[model samples]
Target chain A: SAVISQKPSRDICQRGTSLTIQCQVDSQVTMMFWYRQQPGQSLTLIATANQGSEATYESGFVIDKFPISRPNLTFSTLTVSNMSPEDSSIYLCSAECSGNTIYFGEGSWLTVV
Target chain B: SQQGEEDPQALSIQEGENATMNCSYKTSINNLQWYRQNSGRGLVHLILIRSNEREKHSGRLRVTLDTSKKSSSLLITASRAADTASYFCAPFSSNTGKLIFGQGTTLQVKP
Candidate 1:
């Protein structure tokens, strides 16, 4: 198991602005992922953060909207650009550790006005 | 696209009773995992059952998987008020590291 942390545990942002959520892991991990949980709904994968390379985004999500950066094994960031009320959701960062078990950060709850 | 769907979107149960949630997936998977999330919080991993295994237990939680039917169930015994949260089932594909999450079941345990 790994200890994961995210910054700005909760934030209220204005529309047309941007907020970047940071995720830090206690140890180096092979893969880091970003997910969004819409209100009253399930999680949707936004992208996969790969160390030293471009992130792989899922369908319905774009790099321009949700750009990701994984400079090292233990750190990554996801920025939601031009925020809107519809973008208000709980953003979670996760890592796949040993035995293929996944661990998640406490999550960054963003509320766009 | 999402791969799993859990039945009984919302459940209310008394403390000390048992709560069960069911999940069904579309494709074959190497492993399926159950996770719990408090309102407005991130998810916590509960347990994982591999395709080759039928059932697994951890503390008060039991998970059973049927690969042939592509479905799974999670049973929580002696539920408590603190157990009130949403539960989700995620199936990980062996080929891609992607994990498809279910719609989730909201369980409210009354004290």
Candidate 2:
């Protein structure tokens, strides 16, 4: 099992500002992922945070908007740049430990005004 | 885009009643997992059923996966008010180790 922690639990930011959410895992994990959950919706994978290389983002998402950095096996950061009202969502960080079970952080709730 | 779709987006039942939720996916998967989220907070993994397995049980929760139909069902027996939350199904890809989540079903277990 993995214990995940996220910083800035809830924040209200103005439009056009950027916010960086940090995720820290208790143990080194092979896979780390970022997901976004809009109001009253399911989680959408933002990107896969690779340890030593660029992140792999899903379709409809790009590095320019959601830049991810995975400096090591236990730490990663996701930056929501040039934010807008549409970017208001809950961002979650999850890590896959062992092989099957995935653990999630409390999540960072960002509200753009 | 997510790979699964859950039926009965919302459910309301008594605390002692049982609750059942179903999920259907479009693609082949290595395993299917159930997760519960409380009021839009973090997600807690409930149970996981591999493609080769048909049914699995964890305490009061029972999960069944049918690979032939690409569907799965989760049953919570004798639920409590604490069980009120949104439930989601995630299809895991063995090749990539990625999980795709469905919309989710909101269960309201009134005490």
Candidate 3:
């Protein structure tokens, strides 16, 4: 299992502003991903962070809105662009380890006012 | 990716009791994982069971995977107040390599 750390664990932002959440893994991982949990709903896959390449976004998530960058195997960032009140959610970063077991970070909780 | 369906949207039990939750997936999976999330907090990986394995135990948590039925179950023996949280099940082995999370079962352990 890999240890994941996320920055800006909790933050409050104004509508229309953008917030970038950083994720750092203790060791190199084969796969990195971003997930969003809105209010009481279950977490949804936002994108798959590919090192040295463009991230693959999931349905209902656009790169323009939730841009992700993975400069290396151990680090990635997710930026919520043009945020709205509806964009308030807990953003989580995860890495897949051996045997397809994934570990999650503490998560970045963003509240858009 | 197939999403898992968790049985019993919510559950309440007394301390020292055993808590059980079931999850069913629509597709075959290489691994199944159970996660716990405290209120407004991050996800905690509880246990992971592979398709080839039938049952696994870690401390007070026991997880069983039934690949033939595409379902799994998590049982927590001797539940405590700290065990109160949201339990979610996710099945791995998707062609897309993305994890689909179930709505989760909210477990409340009253002390």
Question: Which candidate has the highest TM-score of all?
Answer: 3
C-alpha lDDT (0 to 100) for residue B64 of candidate 2: 94
Candidate 2 is scored at a TM of: 0.96
Worst 10 residues of 3 chain A by lDDT: A94-103
Q: Is the docking of candidate 1 incorrect, acceptable, medium or high quality?
A: high
What's the lDDT of the predicted structure labeled candidate 1?
A: 0.93
Note the residue pairs that clash in candidate 2.
none
Q: Candidate 2 lDDT, tens digit per residue, A12-80?
A: 999999999999999999899999999998999999999999999999999999999999999999999
Listed per model in order, the count of residue pairs whose N, CA or C atoms clash below 3 Å is: 0, 0, 0
For candidate 3, lDDT tens digit of each residue in B1-111?
A: 389889989999999999999999988787888999999988899998988899999999999998888889999999999999999999988575768998999999999
Model 1, stretches more than 4 Å misplaced? Answer: none
Tens digits of lDDT, candidate 2, B7-111:
889999999999999999888888888999999699998887889999999999999999898999999999999999999999887676788887799999999
Model 1 per-residue lDDT tens digits across residues B58-111: 999999999888899999999999999999999887688778787799999999
lDDT of 1 by residue, A1-113 (tens): 88999998999999999999999999999999999998988899999999989999998999999999999999999999999999999999999988788899999999999
- Give each model's whole-structure lDDT: 0.93, 0.92, 0.93
**Interface RMSD for each of the candidates:** 0.7, 0.9, 0.6
